[model samples]
Target: MKFPNPHYPNLRYPNRRYWYVPILSALLLLLNGGVNLALMRPLTDVPASMDKLRFHLDDAVFSLFFLLAAAVFAGAFSVLRRERGYLYLSFFSLMASQQFFWEWDGKHLLFGDFPVLPAESLAVKSGMTFAAFLFFRYLQGTNRRLTDRIFIYSAGGVWAMSVISSISPLASPLLPFLSGALLAIVLAYLLLAAGRFAHRFRRYPEDSELRLIVNGFAVFAILILPDVGKDVLQVLTGQRLGYLPVFWEACLEDTFPWALMQLIFVFGLLFFRRYMRVLEQNREAHAEIRTQHESLKQEVAIRQHMDRLLDALSGSYRLKDLEHTLVAEGRRLFEPHSFHWIPYNRKARSIDNSIDNPGLDSGELRELEELLFAADHGLVPGEILPGSKFAPVFIGVMGREELYAAISPKGRPLLERERFALQLLAKYGALFLDYYAMMEKRISELERYHGEQPWVGKLFMQMAEKERKRLASDLHDEVLQELLAARRWLEGSGSADDPMPAPERMRLALDNAEFMIRETCAELMPSFLSEHGVIHAVLKLADKMRVRADFQLEVRTGTLAAKLDDDLSLTVYRIVQELLNNAWKHSGAARVGLDMDQEAGEIVIRYADDGKGMDAEAAGMSPDRFGLRGLNERVRLMGGSASIDTRPDEGFRAECRLPLKRTATAPA
Candidate 1:
């Protein structure tokens, strides 16, 4: 019996191809770099009128463009790879891009070109503040609903701030202070995000990706801190500081720091792709393991169910009991909506519907009978009947007799293990039915003859007790006397020059004592009966009888004689021994014929002799005269019949039929 392996329908992992995303991002980055280089002027060719401060300002503008392009590429990679950290990185890049554009316009202001409007400056600052709030909120892992509410409230607040700063004359003076305050808030949020990432890295020390994120956040925060400090100083004093040189101020305050932050973010994004791939692989491996574990558990449960069903069925001895057990076990295993037994009536040549369940309608019952008749032996797969909601399975119990079951409409179809269990149930059911039929017939026969026969139990008990006393007396008188005489002879004075040696005399006495003991044991329970069964014991009995009596004995037996159980074999052997003894001692028979055979589930024994016969009527009236009454009682006790045929001057003939209780070796 092989069980099929369980399959998981939803465990399939798609083979998604993501190899081309990095290749496309790299090509776009190169093209953007080439265009920036083509637009920029040479630094060494600046005119003498242009001071070092102006020259550094032009160089800073070129670097800001490069930094902007890099930030865009990193944001694109984060989006394409679908990293969890992409939201924070994207919003922060937008905030930085707005700040850089404001600085480029400020550089034009330094040369007295006032093309930028005050309203436009306030609007860009408001946009930068909004992007910073969103970036901080997402970094803290806020829920979607709360994040959406924050976005709405912040957008309204920043819009109102921009409108007030543009329309009110007093608000224009406070705009620089407001911008500095916003930059300080953004710097504080960047540090908070870095601290959070650092705490996470400590919690999961094995995750190198978390450590890399913590380092990236810390680096970006440190680079932007100086610019925030410079803005704070300018807002407090209400005047630009002239302590640092122009070149250092342009490079350290904004351009150099922002470019380095963008570069670090781009490299981190590339490493994140590899880390996400590893995480996906781990998830797939864990899912496969869980699936296999579930499959193994199901297999063990199926094996246990089979063992439990077999144990229950093996103990059943009657047809009704077996049917009930099958139904109970089937219900537990299959959870069927309905279950029943359909018995075949051999005499009527049809199904016996009289004892069927009342729940079954006429149409369903008739369809079941038809299916049982049409189906072959063993398990028949389920099929839907004409008016049935569920398919019914027909399992043959014996010949045309079957067990019927219908699964529930919503239940799944039978699995391989369940079908195997049904097949096993059918086989055991058939065997139990056959054995039950034999026992039932034996019981009925006993009931018919029970009233006519004398009570054999008390009689047999009394005879057994008397036989034991006789055996004890024989051992004490014969064997004990021989051993005592031998012991006395060895102790007494020996005569010299005797014909027989003294040791020989003692050995002879011991041999006789041993033989007497063996003979007594044989009479109580023959060795051949226990060793070989009834047929061999009968042959040995005849051989011994031939040596003791003047009659010739002939014995014949069949193959089934070897298959009888120990109790039945012993009883049959005793019957044959008794009949042979009676014929030798009372009938004065010259020859005897003992025949044994099996037919119609019974053992038949026949005995005949050529000797003077007595009157049949006289022997029936006085059964104890030749121990004939005891013999008849023995046969009756075994649910059998015995008869003797005799007449004056004719041979005696007797026949007995005993019920056969077969052993494991018996044919099915």
Candidate 2:
């Protein structure tokens, strides 16, 4: 027996080409009928026994029928190892084999009476009937719920009528006719189911598996008519002798089996092909999953390292630690070569920050300075100079003229995340030195005023403000750009099979990040302050608070005074900021007002809010809260005095007086 070919997963099969399989099967059926009739014409005088022995065509053809059934079973098993479609097909092959043996017994020897057992023959016929029913039941489209019920009822009606006929001889004649009608009904419905299957997959004509199924069933329906109707046709035209019809009669039984076998073969191929496709898809899916999982792991590790580094950089601020911390952070971020401070003394090879390296010899140091300065660092340190060999970023101070240290990253254009982190270190490095800005030119003033830990707290808060600004800038440049690019890729070119559903959600997240960064940057350093000085900064802060706190704020800063220095300007802004927070949080103020002016070469800032008040003396003892105590501490550090006046029923008021020593040439 032959078997259907095992499907090659890579082999392409076009459904359009497979339409020929059914067409050829139909043509062969007609050809078989015509040939049999022509051959039988000249053998009218020979006995049926002699006719069988003389021409082996009928014998050879029946043998092929058995092979075709085997092929069909093989094909069904190829698709799914456990699918019942193959099990049902096994039954069909058995029936075909039984029929072949029945023919063999009849034609065993000349004039031989080699009859099959009555019970065995009856069993084979019954088995074939059930197998055909199951074939219709299990195929994809024919197995629909409503369709299965119809098949069951139709088979049941045929069975009940046959049993009734067996119990009474008088009704036995109608049994054959009833069985024929039921068979016709079953075949008709099978054709309808096949047609519906084809219709459903019409748009997907390249699907060869589905095409084979539809076309194979169509061939079965086409051959079933002539094969089942031959007896009726012969009886109805019994007296009319026609050679062509007679030969066709001789061929019907032979031709129908071939058509049926061919249909089964097609079905087997379809199933096998479907199974191969499933395996390929599973492999591809697994590969994709592994790639995504590895990528996720790497991202998690990078983020953890970044978080740890950022925490370390933001928290530490000692003057001695700044140079070392800045250089170390750069090396971690960019992996640069030879991180050492640029020396100050005329001929010392050792750098100013005390880290000695042979790479920066006196002559080499001068050459390095010239190269770094020309590379766009603008004479201040912490400038990253990208070099093809030995990328060196400067992080410590250089040149004797400048008192503060300079930090530099020596590398060729660090990665986006690395550059962002290094820039943060540089921004704070500059501000950390400014914590001892008084020691630079006015060391005497520091000795004159002592506010204890309050002075240290003010420096810490100032450094914190610098960090906030740096972080906001980094988010805007690095994270925001990447998110927008990712969004555009998803919108323009993402595949439909992608797991992430909506590009719009990424867009919404991007918009939210942008807004948050903008607000943070503005809060850290008001845009209006640098351009229009402290007056506008106060007005803008109040305008924003009016909307947020639902309060009214009035500011007055009209008096004779020179432009203030950055220290006094930031100090005044923070004083007013602290007072506003107290009024809104503690006082529950609906109306708050602030007034600032210089009196006796002094800067005065006084603010009051209409809200519930607290004891001024009691509030001063509260520690760690940036309130009245903090305001007074800030005032005392700048050689100034702070006063808070409040009562239970009346509003809240905070006043600060600081001597502003600034020349007209100073830039605020």
Candidate 3:
């Protein structure tokens, strides 16, 4: 609801009782009551003229009171803004206007001397009483449809009787009876109102204001009904109850109207006080409800924004795409000037510097990094470091490692709520970045693996070919020469055309060729691998490593399957051989452990060494490190994934999972 004032949140009214208003109203009523007694009782010899004694002491008091009541009701009509108020105003104004006419004639004012006839006095009473009937029902909040029909018809009949009496003297006898009937209707309505208030008083017994209002109404009804009964009795019986009758008339004239005014004044003041207090309370309640509604709207928007951000981040593998999305969404809320990124490692730079911040140079970015590292305060606002352009910075971390961002907002600093949102975004952004980086690294490694597949294949084939050619050269140059010489010696011993040769020399040349052929067979393909399985071959290599390299090699094969395929076994042998070669050449420590397991159609190998490990990025797949690169290629060719974790001081650990289960045919 719109308030009484649009800007002010609450309404203030003069609700505290104006105690003197009712007291003054009562005093005026008593003064008028005194005037009524003086005018009616002391003037026993007064003329009973049709147009005399209208203006007198009672007339002057009536005018003063009517004028005051009219003023009060008119103000009430303005403030109450109810039709019931209008009804009271109409009644009071009619009474006041009638009394004013009684004090003033057509041309001049008359006080204490104006004249009145019985018919004229009766007409005035008829109008004032009609207004009172309407006011009484309206003030009680009664159902007025039936009452309206009854009162209107009754008043009309009374007036009709009065009109007939004015036209013909014969109808004058019925006037008192009609007046008594009208007064009876008013009295009945007052009794009904009193009964309703009494029922409410019983329902809410502790309500002090209600109790006061009910008491006033009860007092008014009791006092006013006595006047109605006395007047009705005189009209019906034509027998005046003369003893103590004047005492009753004086009490009716003085106390009757005063009781009615007392109830009306108290009820009105009390009702207005409660109404204003309720209005103020409603104003506060509506304000709180609106504030809560606004907060709920903000929270919903924040949740939707977070959902959108997560959607953008889910599939974003590149840092640049993620950066662009961050800028766009951050612009929606914060409108920062630019978004800059820096790496924890000073060497690695921002993914998008030229696009996000065109003029910012690398030197400034490094300085920002320095300032962040040197900042003493935590992540609350107003914790700016000296010589820092960023007023608020949100740091992101992954595990123990820290990542960086300059985050120089364009204009003013972020609000506390915005900073909190940014911190949330930054944390999730860092986590997603780590995930994307891992994926990007794997993709690059697979690319390098594929690219090197053919080259690694060619290099191994070239080495095998070179080894075979060297064996062929040795057999041709030395073994063939010895055999030819032994043949010549045999030919010389057999005939005169052959050169001189002994039987012992021929036997020695044959022995030398046999030994050279055995050495070539061993170099080309070890016979031990063909005779034994992959496990035996690996244990043999460990034995050789223990005897020759002084390395403690422990091997576990509890989960390894028996009877590996020829190709698989060859691949495993080469892998173990290359691992040992790298461990012996690069690693200076003496301990190595290898665990081989084949479970549920997959081959898993875990190799670890307590050795001086090398830089992982530098040594894993570098050009010079052909051993690890070749081992990775061999695993890739078998359709597998390989990972090597190494640090400078920590031990090197390598794991390879290869799908090498053989059924009808080996996997391509």
**Residue clash pairs of candidate 1:** none
TM-score, per-candidate, Cα-based: 0.35, 0.42, 0.39
> Per-residue lDDT of 544-609 in model 2, one digit per residue for the tens?
667656677777877545777677778888788767766665777778888888788998888888
Record all residue pairs in model 3 with backbone atoms less than 3 Å apart, i.e. clashing.
52-115, 52-116, 53-115, 54-114, 54-115, 55-113, 55-114, 56-112, 337-410
Off by over 4 Å in 3: 1-55, 75-83, 92-177, 207-209, 219-253, 274-668
For all candidates in order, the CA lDDT equals 0.60, 0.60, 0.62
**Model 3 local distance difference test score:** 0.62
What are the per-residue Cα lDDT tens digits for candidate 1 across 1-668? 00000111122222333343344334333433343343332456765335434533534565465456547656655655543334444554554555555556335535566444455565655665565455445434443555345554655465467668767667677677666655555556556555655676566554434444444444454555666687789989999864233333433444233434544454445335555565687798899999888867766776676677778877877666777876777666655444455565434446666654545677866666665455544444342233344345554445544445544333665555555555555555555566677777777766654654544444566566656765888799879988986896698654565577778888988998998898778868776676877787888788878887888888888877337776778778888988887777787887889999998889999999888888877558363443566677667767788988988779888999987753332110
Candidates 1 and 3 compared: the better one by TM-score is 3
lDDT of 3 by residue, 447-500 (tens): 776686677556566545644665788689867888887887778744554453
The superposed Cα distance between candidate 3 and the true structure at residue 520, in angstroms, equals 66
lDDT of 2 at 388: 25
In candidate 2 the C-alpha lDDT for residue 422 amounts to 50
